[model samples]
Target: MQVRNRQRLTLPGCSSSGGSSGGSSGGSSSSDNTLAAVGMTKNQFRCVFNPSTNRDVLGRANTAAMIDKHWTQFTSAASQLNFRFGNLDEAAVFFGMVRHEYGGYLDDMRENCARQGVACRQYDTCRQGGNNYYGRGPLQISHCYNYEAMSQYVGVNLRSNPNALLDANNNLGWRASIAFWTRPEFNCQGTWEAVRAFPTCPAAARAGNIAAVSQRINGKVECNQNPRPANQDNRVSWIQNVRTSCFGLPRLTSNLYC
Candidate 1:
């Protein structure tokens, strides 16, 4: 199975500015200290600054720590990925994907990989020796070619050091997610193009064309498996949860499920 970077959202204020409200979320230690000191929830302080994760998934405690540890890397990656959206509709759908993919935690990411049999192997014959490109980072990028591509894009030489994706401080993993989002693949256009297209493209997302978006990232409906575990269904459910929790959109009425 080919593992691609799927459904990574750029958090509000994490990406570059597209509108007045959506400024860069990268702040200094003092800001983080202040947020933590004030006893604010992750939703209030806005955790995972770039491509905000679901507050329920990350919670206040983990969100605060992630902000303090990986905010800089997340911001850098968000800028490159163009996480900032022109409207709330675009944000809802895009971030929905992010929440579905990462849930703002490493353990959740690992579990997803395990379910799909991705990045769990010891070695791969498809590429050079010792290239264990098991799922790492927010997007769970796999395969050696992907590692090489990400290495070139992020200037990290991931092909040589495949384990670099596991580093939270350096955040090679999140960067790989962003890199994957911007590039085109799976026969559908890139998310960058869709987000940048403004009203028209965002309208599609807002209208609940999630099936189309899934194809853009996943190549096909991997979520709708038959007779057993439903990957696509789970993804759709996460997107719905994210829309409700992160964006405060209508929980039941919104056309979130694909």
Candidate 2:
């Protein structure tokens, strides 16, 4: 059986959110300014994130106010980790990954833990707790180890309450996703490093590489495969679409595949 780690990308209609254009600003002090710097307006964000068919994910609507609230929290979390969105390219890649992973649904779940085989060993505590920690949140952060780590990083007891990652009221899902994006853990730091260094780093690693970011997110299952996994292609395509359609970029940077 194929182990589905990420959801298939389905591009939605999106329009550019005009704003400033430049490299990273080291870090932004204001979430509103950061959003503008990254060229993400309420409509663009909603176009890419809000599901067209559903009233909302679970019971929470991805409303403009909710999106603003989440974006604020996301910026705060990135700042806490000494990271920043920097530019439109970085924002495209980040949101692209989120689109591929969660498909804009907050209640999306990845069940069937036993199929993970040896990977399930590290999350024994979550299994014993009678809660399957397969995947949750915007990035679909899986495993008990990740939950414990994120709990420590966010000062939340996710180990005891993994469901909190899906709670829109507390805005833990977006916070956990941003924390995962900033920290280096999943064997690929390109996602974090690319965005983090956009301001000062050289051109080679400056704009961010979607391929490297995808590798970091799920290289074990999708990268370096014989058939060029459809999910991988979908990820790249979705990100590129976000770049051109959402942010009005001509094309992606470099290294677009893993």
Largest TM-score belongs to which candidate?
Answer: 2
Off by over 4 Å in 2: 1-8, 17-44, 50-65, 79-82, 107-129, 185-206
Clashes of 1: 10
Query: What TM-score against the true fold does each predicted structure earn?
Result: 0.61, 0.70
lDDT of 1 by residue, 1-258 (tens): 234334343233332121222222444343433222212222322432333433322242234446545545665566666654444445556556655565456434442444355565553634556656666666566667677767776678877887677776675666677566555541223335533332233445656666656655553335334552355666566655545544545544543233
Give the per-residue lDDT digits (tens) of candidate 2, residues 102-148. 64544443322322333432335655767656667767778777888
Q: After aligning candidate 2 to the native by TM-score, how far in Å is the CA of 31 from where it should be?
A: 12
Specify the poorest-scoring 10-residue window by lDDT in model 1.
Answer: 15-24
**Candidate 1 TM-score versus the reference:** 0.61
- What is the C-alpha local distance difference test score of each model? 0.50, 0.57
